[model samples]
Target: MTKPIQGFSKLTKEEKIDWIVSNYTHDAESAKIILKRYWNDDEALQNLHDEFIENTITNYYLPLGIAPNFLINGKLYAIPMAIEESSVVAAAGKAAKFWLDRGGFKTTILGTEKIGQVHFMFSGDADKLKSFINSVETKLRSEASDITKNMEKRGGGISKIELRDKTADLDNYYQLHCTFETLDAMGANFINSCLERFAKTFKQEALHFSEFDETEKNIEIVMSILSNYVPNCLVRAEVSCPIDELADNDTDANEFAKKMIQAIEIAKAEPHRAVTHNKGIMNGIDAVILATGNDFRAVEAGAHAYAAKDGKYTSLTDASIENGIFKFWIEIPLAVGTVGGLTSLHPLVKLALEILQKPSAQELMQIVAVAGLAQNFAAVRSLVTTGIQEGHMKMHLLNILNQLGANETEKATLTEHFKKNSATHSAVVEAFENLRKGI
Candidate 1:
């Protein structure tokens, strides 16, 4: 086993990549090979290579910042999140501080079972078809069981099969939900593979269809698809802070809590607001998802779909203040993994998993739940006070300066001038020249 990289944040961009490559089973040459294999465009590949040299692989690195002072489930952790958004890390840190000041974040994960869907299109009677599916449940389970034998040996396998009715269209469509215990893996591939195998067996043994193909029958099988209505496997986190911890003289801490709740309610009421609201939650969760090389797109799709499950858009996080304490909670569909796929192939992702010290998939989900809740806290706190643009623009100025390539001294002068006045690119250039002449 390779020893993990230490003090990653202390290293420069180049040093960080070097540390990741050196510690993992990959080197610069190997990284290049992997990059070329994925990216076919010569110019795009060159750009990546050039950016790698500049230590600007921001996509792979941004969420790596450590969230300190977090004590979840009575265990201390220094969590590293990779995200592009501003204020996420700061917000999580502040929330962690508030919780630690009281006790800490108390969280629980209810097993890891992701739902896979196999859509069946049958012309037969709905009642008879339903009976047929139920009759073959055991056979389907056995088929699923055989596919996940490895996971079964590791204490994870198919747990249940559920059927849902769909009569919105002229054609009758039945959805088969295969629930599987994923153990410490996200199990998208596993679930989909098992569902396909079960579908094959269902047609061969039960449906009596000599020729059944997932594509030909218009039978769509999807894995790890977002179901906000996911059965079980919910991760719940609660953080209680003394009312004084949320103190802001402008608003009573308890009143502040009410306002936070009200703001979330507003997001819950309107689709427009809920989009931004859920985006805030993803701003935190997606970072960790990406860091661990999980499928963020699938996670995002599922979370948003879940938010709208009740036919009304709403915030996924709920906040309350009671008896001189403020509490925050969120339960979102976070299907993430610690091992397999990119976690095994990507060097940086492997390094991130190492930094996380190889947490179980369930434990990882709870941590992500905390992050989503923390992100909501941050967004709400900002919306309630100081407006989002104030801090966002302050951080965005660095990018504007970098685009202009201002040196350290130039950057400081430019930043100062920009703060003093609504500085433009012309103004920045003028400041750059003035500072260069030592005028």
Candidate 2:
């Protein structure tokens, strides 16, 4: 067995790769070749990628695609989406185009309050702890001033601090819950900096407070960090039109609206359907989040938690047809930033923001929410009418063809052929095989 090697990180890049492959990989030479093959040709770009995280090896690339005709708040946009999925961009584009002539999407920023917490354990007089907490709110803000000065100047700073008692959930558990307005930044770093300062001040002040005994003053700080769950940092995107105008060349307008509402209702009432339903919405949201170098994982976590906010996991979207008007909307928590992190650093991210017309953080939130709503609308419209597989499989045809190793001419021919016949893996494979056999 290969034993653990010391100073593995200190080894030369080539030596480290050789050791790792020699010890673990089945084909060491091929593994090395694959790793080196993905490295950027430009030294500067390679260095930039390496600095994004620790122990970097080679850059991993995802395709960057543009979905055009996104009409949001009366402005036209071509959204950049970076994703590996075959049909996400196509689905989003279809939705955007469908809504473009139908009055487009309208968005509203419900709130912009981010949250953080300083968790601690205190086994002392509950009343005394409560009293101390009330007195420290001002001190917490005052002490965190250094950290918040710049943010305050930009009209973003500490909103409030509250002492939350949670001893019923666990023994001696409590939290200093804090809220802030981060303006044009997602402000994870800024919020975290302020939280750490508050934690330090809360602990140190307890050290010399005359009202506390030796054991009582010994408040043990568990952790101080920003929360990904920012329900108050929400955005709403909705599209509305007269029910009569909802018709297509083939589908009836009123029936289509009712079918769409019924589909949403099913998702709201069933967990099994809601998970997949919400995932389809995230398919579009995550693509834009990733394209702009924001945290999609955080957005995913917050959104799913919000979906379950009613004590049961449900759909993030809603649909209704009433009084000759049909409406579809979604209110989602998305704490994205127009500045900071990779937004200012990554070349592609900068370009993506430029393509977005350099929107403010609030504008970006609106756009992301609109993207999610559009994606869900398209998915549900397909699900209720033509069936989802029709368009999805069509979009997935190129992927299947590539997987079957079709060359230029075959791919071109198959691409045209699939438009006439249904595209499926087995069918494509059989056709390719028959073509190979001169059939």
Ten-residue region with minimum lDDT total, candidate 2: 50-59
Model 1 agreement with the true structure over 1-439: per-residue lDDT tens digits: 7776566666765576565666664467686455345442566544644454344433432537777777888887777788776667877787677677667878887646677777776654566656666777888777666677899899888887887776576466667776777877778778778877777776666435324334333343332232433536678877777777777547677667778878978887888998998898888788888778787887788787778778887888877777767777887777777878777766677777777768888888888888788777777887887677655555567776787777787788778777865454565567667777788
Choose the strongest candidate by lDDT. 2
- List ranges where model 1 is wrong by over 4 Å: 1-63, 168-170, 207-231, 248-252, 415-439
Could you give the C-alpha RMSD of every candidate to the true structure, in order shown?
A: 10.3, 1.2
On a 0 to 1 TM-score scale, where does candidate 1 land against the true structure? 0.76
Model 2 stretches with alpha carbons more than 4 Å out: none
Q: Estimate candidate 2's alpha-carbon lDDT, on a 0 to 1 scale.
A: 0.92
Give the whole-model CA lDDT for all candidates, comma-separated: 0.71, 0.92
Cα displacement (angstroms), candidate 2, residue 348, comes to: 0.4
| Candidate 1 lDDT | 0.71
